[model samples]
Target: MDTKISVVENGALKRVGKVFAEAFGQTPALLVADGNTLKAGGFETLRSLKEAGIVVRQYIFPSNPQPYADEYAIQIVHETLKQDNSIAVVLGSGTLNDITKRASSELDRPYMVVATAPSVDGYTSYGAAVSIGGFKQTLPCAAPLVVLADTKVLCKAPTDMTASGFGDCMAKFTAGMDWILADLLGVHPIRKDVWDMVQTPLRKVYKKRSSIARREASAIGILFDALSASGFAMQIMHDSRPASGAEHLISHVWEMEHLSKDGLPVSHGFKVAVGTMTIRYLYDQLKMVDINSISLIGGESWADRERAVRSFFKDPKVAEQTVVIAKKKFLEGEALSKRRETLLSIFPTLIKRIDEQLPPYAELKEAMRMNGAPVSPEDIASNLEGLRHAVTGAQMIRDRYTVLDLFYELGIFDQALESLQLM
Candidate 1:
């Protein structure tokens, strides 16, 4: 909601000066970018700002290792920005933008992003996915004051990056399904306007898979729009429930484990793409489940659940924190039994919703394939065993009510895990 301006144009980079001047009015700006983004839009961005008579400073991250949105990275940027009164202007995708967002928030200042790729929807969202002490978490922050994207730059991004963006956008299918499920269970109801904002454009982009794969400007612009809309949806909800669900949880598990290739962590979209496939597959399997056979296995005792959380996290401090967070949502005994009854009572409707909300698993895979996005675990350098582990870890880490929670509650999680075949 804090984001006041949103620009998507063929030559948006050239409007950096006018837009920045209009918003902040001659305030010195701190331009943040990695070496790659700096090369891509730095010159033009700087020229535009100077032409508008805006004083600007540049903070370029080295490209070799690629900057991460981790505590160390946040600290470095925060330290640098604290020295000046410059408004932050991030000029990259996920990580750089997250770094700037968190740092600016710490300084009680707002920032803007000049998105180089449609990579992820964190740009206008008021949270930063950052790792501290090796644990991944979405730290609260201010949404960008402006989100500017140039289709010309976006279309030229690496095919995998754009495809990754498509994958992230596509995950909205399952995200929406999860929200609907939560709504049904009285966990969190959907906001109709936010739902329409995210879901409508999502369907449009999903239909343009080939165009996105071909790097067409129009298609890429739509992808950016949908991604930004997703951020706005999250903003409206004041939480990620509207935009992230089980798929993102899987990505979070992978992040905690540092899943990587060629010494670099996998992109968020690539991980979520595979997560989307996994969740869709689970939903497909859900169709075959016999609700009558889903006997109530009493929920784990809090002490036992706490132990599992501690063991799963492998960090005493983090495990302690997780237990405190989990305590609120961890059900037991009569509560668990009643929950099972409620789930049983709603089983038919739940199935109908799943059927209505999800595309066929094969169809979803085809869409991902059409966009050159990774459609399987192996494509993202992960295997079923590893993903199963991630899925388990994901369920334990977050108390959010997702399909994963439903499956876990019903004692069908292991069965569903075993059902996954090589894709």
Candidate 2:
């Protein structure tokens, strides 16, 4: 639960090299970054390490720069860790940091992150999502030994990236709700400290919606603080449940489908943003949990679920692999079913419970827009199909106790699809 990295003033990134020097003695640093980030922040990081009397070695991901976490990337980072006995220093956020965190953990080397954006909460999480044998999965890993986010530079990050971060942060609202539901059903034990650590900053960000839009120094700083808190929560729980939810699953499904326009991959937070809208809409329509409708649910058979799995992956082997990951990694079957009923049985009345602990959706949307985030699904991409795909896939990727899963279990998925069309 100790958050190692510090988000300091603008010029502090240049001092990271020296800080590492003092912590681990004068040693070389293996700097890992992407092509764009290398230009934006990598050069300065390299210079700072050299000036601080530490040896420097750099390794950027290969080719025309596609940011992903696959076997090839994991192997490359592993090689870099072995090439020299230097501590790994990742200079970008999310994808780059995830790949490095997994690779260095495998190499058993200490690692640190210098975040370039107010991005996803994964900055300090202990697990990494990677495609080991073609299926996207979150493999267990360790948290970074340190995290450094320079707020000045982060405030100026691309609007879309900032928006994605907000989407990821907003996810905590529904995600926490799902966790509480699971707790009520005794599906899993809840950790109150971990939950509050992730949820507290959410209220603060919404309260300063106007200031956040101005990108005032204090606003961006506070936003980043909230983002970091989620990471620390993951470190404490050693699970993403405190942060990720049905929204993240949708993003993964998009990734597997290779769903891009003209070959450009979408941002993770963008997909999650749209997914958040889809799930929230579903939540709004429920008349009741309808515990008796569980038996009326369609596609409860293994063959039926497998068919949905086929739609997600082309290779039959990959399809089987996908099912295996879902079954093993995600908590499914009886437990999720019972919890869905308990949560839904509470229904519209539970809205009061959710409101008591979370910010109003409208206020949160304003905070995100002011912070340069997507306010709706349409704000993320060009078409509604992408949003549809994100919603359906979000349901498939995780076994978390979220409202989306509740909708699917209660036979309202089709109706939800119809509602999405209206949107």
Candidate 3:
């Protein structure tokens, strides 16, 4: 894993000048931020850096939410890099962090983040999910050298954004469970060390949910630690399988469709939160039915059960994806026997370990309420149609082996879809 130095003290930012001076040895830093964050704390951060005798250059974009982390925004940072050899520092959350992460990777320079909100997990992750040519994808990037979050700033963030973060964090429960399933099926290898590292801070933070909402030092510190550890997990594994799963894909669909409510786009975490519920509902329904008996009720009406995806997708594409996955499993039956058995042997242990780390959805929601996070799918999407569309969208991209793929291969997708209507 890349060396991650996280400094997130309440008044620690005031000492940023001294910190930067000590770490960089006179090397200058390019401060990247958008208007909202500039107004929020960019000036103070800059002043502190200069006060510590560190030379600095600053870039600020207008406050419009749309002017963030697109190819155009990244271009400006890329072009600015031509003028100097300075490490980059993002003074905002979400887009600012993503753009800087991508830009710094392109420049082959280390970057750090001064997080102004707890809006998303891309903060410390090694890969950045961005929209390129109107398609949503996760592109390779380097993790930040340091991650600093001021709880004061995080607590002051817009309530919806905080809710989005809560939603994203909660999705980890279902996502982690799916990871266990994939391990059982022998589709992928699970990294026990990485899993434990990211999970430790998660346990501490979840237990202190009210403190996070109140911006208590210890609680915010734990959240920040877990977030950073998550980034490191991706850095070490070189994949997001340990972190994001189908829930993130659902969010991507919303991004591609440009869905919004009340004239504003919903945050990524918010979309995933609802997707989490939808997936759990699917599992809950499954516990009451027999997987083998599924097709008898609904014919394998999905598309061909031998392919990975459908280039032309609509709301019911999940059904098609399911049939395709099911056929693949049928073919792999003989070869995957040992692997499946190994996964089964370890799955119970994985679930037990995960429970020790992250909170369940119900408990997670209570934590969110305490931390000022949002509570429902309606809270993230503009309307019900948008939510369903995003969930369907998630099915199309990333042939990543996930629980969604598992049910699809098992020909039980229709069951998952029908369950969504109840939510």
Candidate 4:
């Protein structure tokens, strides 16, 4: 929880200098942005810092190709920071902030952010979602010390960016349900305070979806606040379990493969939106299953599981990493029996939590559609087949207990996946 200052308001960008001065008095600052984000708020941020008597250095990444959060980008920023003692003030949303988060963390320094969009929740989270060796993962990083977002700027952000943020916010519904499943099964119990921190604002944003589409300042402010609350929840828990679940894991799998459309990489929120819908559909299907009827007597052998992981992930390095993680939670023999028994014992409670936690599948889909989020796999430059693979791959990539694991453990993962009618 390194963040000391968090403000989302109209014209908050005007307070950048004052806020920076308060957070890091008289410290020289490095302003980071790309061409598009530079126009968004970089100049104002620079001007404010200079007016506050702070020396400022600039790192303007080219905007044509759009910056990505990758090891190479982190290296460039890492080298830049190595040459000076200036604290970083990242001026964009997801990509730029992620790069700076990892780069600054490498030097054991805290950074600040002036959000250009309500794009993603990694803004004040403890881990940076980045690609290393072409594999997407969350790398350790310190959350920003100060987070400032001006609704004036946010309301003008590209509609898709706002929609992306909305998608990410909506994901909390499914992510929270996943947590409930874990908590009920005695894997990772929910923390009441952190649960309220994220879930409360999520509902507020859901109510204001239409206003958010209209880019109403109040609605955008609510979206931004909800996104920040998710980050704060992760900070408090020191694990993404508070803010991420299987939906994010599905996004990670797609990110690893560089899922893109129309010559541009797909936004994280778009990918997660699809995952959210997909997971919710699975939850609906889960309700129809009778725990007594499920035959969990035999399951995939470890050797077969290893083969599937190796075959699904083409890159040997990725396959290697996934195999290691998959091995940790691949239950069989007595372990499988015990897990099945526990699931059976908790079946009624699991269904109860799912009922209370998730919206109806059709209603959830309508919400995503009305908010301009992708409602089908095709909307994300992925097909049903690709999504199916992504779901299985997602299960293998993380040891996190999710509904994916539940079906897999029940020995009906393929049946469950095939039952999904996401055309």
> Relative to the true structure, how large is the alpha-carbon lDDT of every model?
0.87, 0.72, 0.67, 0.89
TM-score of each: 0.94, 0.84, 0.83, 0.95
Q: Residue by residue across 158-227, what tens digits does model 4's lDDT show?
A: 9899889999998999999999999988999889999999999998998887888788999999999999
Better of 2 and 4 by lDDT: 4
User: Candidate 2 local accuracy as lDDT?
Assistant: 0.72
| True-structure RMSD, every candidate | 2.0, 3.9, 4.3, 1.7
Off by over 4 Å in 2: 1-5, 60-68, 132-135, 287-314, 321-345, 375-389
Alpha-carbon runs more than 4 Å astray in model 4 = none
Q: After superposition, how far is residue 16 of candidate 4 from its true place, in Å?
A: 0.5
Tens-place lDDT per residue, model 1, 316-404, is 77678778767877877888888888888877898988878888888889889988889877887888898888888778777789888
How far is 141's C-alpha from truth in model 3 (Å)?
1.9
lDDT of 1: 0.87
Q: After superposition, how far is residue 172 of candidate 3 from its true place, in Å?
A: 1.5
**Residue pair clashes in candidate 2:** 5-147, 163-373, 213-370, 250-394
- Candidate 1 Cα errors over 4 Å, as ranges: 296-304
lDDT of 4: 0.89
Count of backbone clashes, every candidate in sequence? 0, 4, 8, 0
Please give, for residues 229-268, the per-residue lDDT of candidate 2 as tens digits.
8888888877788887776677667767655544576677
Any idea what lDDT model 3 has?
0.67
